[model samples]
Target: MSRDSLSPRSRLVHDALRDAGIPGEIVTLPDAAATAALAAAALGVEVGAIANSLVFWSDGGPLLVMTSGAHRVDTAALAERLGRTSIVRASAEQVREATGQVIGGVAPTGHPAPLPTVVDEALAEFAEIWAAGGTPHTVFPLTFDDLVRLTDGQVAAVD
Candidate 1:
C-alpha cells in the first residue's frame, strides 16, 4: 500500500521502522488482526510466528512486552527478573497513554517515547515474525534479530 493510504498510527509505525533503518513492508489486511490466531490466519503463518505486543504496569511505569503467540507471558517470573515487586496488565487508558495506541494494535516501535521493552526469547526461533502495525488490520514482517534491533528490546524469557 502507498504510504498515504495508511492510517495515522500505522503510518507512524512505518515511518519509525524506516527511520530505524529496518526494512519491511507494512501490509494492510482485509480483516482485523486483533488476536494472534486471526493475524496468523490472515498471514498464513503459524501462530507461534506472531509477536503479540502487550503493555504492562511495572514500577509505576509502562512496560512493553513482545511475546510469542504460542505461550502466555509469565508475569511473576519476568517481574522477578526485572527486580520489580510485580507487573500487572495495563488498562486500556494506560496502554493508550503509554503507546499512543490501543490494545490489539500496539507496535514495538512508534510509541510516544522509548518504553522499557522486553522481547520473548522464544521469538528468536522463528526466522520471520509478524507484528502489529499500530493497527488491528495492518501488520509487518521482519526477522527476529531485526525486531530486537528495531525495538531495542531486552531479550528475555517472558514466558
Candidate 2:
C-alpha cells in the first residue's frame, strides 16, 4: 500500500505502467517526494538507484530525460550529441503542458504524447530503480530493462 495520497495523474501513471507490462505497485510517501534523493531515502535504496524524470526544452520541444540521481545531467553535452542547439530546463507550465503532469511528479511514461527521451546510462548500473509516479508523493519500482522498454528511451551518457 502507498503511504501517501494518490492523485489523478498518479493513477494514470499506474495504468500506464500496467499497460506497459511493468510489474510495479504504486508507493505513497508520507511526505513530499519532489527529489530523487528524498525518494531514495524513503525507499531505502542507493541514491543512484532513483530514476529522476526531468523535462528539457530542446530543438524538438519537450524532451524527457530519465537520469540517475547520483549524477547531474550535462545538458550542453547532451544537446551537442543530439545535434540540438541547446537544452534548457522546462518551466513548470511547459512541463504540465507537455506531460500532463506537474513538475515534481512527472513519470517517464505517462506523457501527453510520445516524447523523445534520453535515459542516463548511469541508471543502468542498478538492476532495480524507482521513479516518480506522476505525483510528488508516489513512486514505483522497476528494472532498468523494464524502464527502457516502458519509456522507449535511448540510453546514453547524458551526464
For each of the candidates, the C-alpha root-mean-square deviation to the true structure, in angstroms, is 0.7, 2.0
Deviation of model 1 at 85, angstroms: 1.5
**Model 1 Cα displacement at 22 (Å)?**
1.3
Model 1 misplaced regions, further than 4 Å: none
lDDT assessment of candidate 1 = 0.93
Candidate 1's TM-score reads 0.98
- How do the residues 1-159 of candidate 1 rate in per-residue lDDT, one tens digit apiece? 777999999999999999988888899999999999999999999999999999999988999999999979999999999898899999999999999998999999898899999999999999999999998899999988998998889999997
Q: Quick one: best TM-score, which candidate?
A: 1
Residue 117: error of model 1 in Å?
Answer: 0.4
Error of 1 at 84 (Å): 1.3
Per-residue lDDT of 50-122 in model 2, one digit per residue for the tens? 9999999998599999999998999999998888899999999899999998888889977778899898989
Stretch of 10 with least lDDT, candidate 2: 1-10
| lDDT of model 1, residue 11 | 93
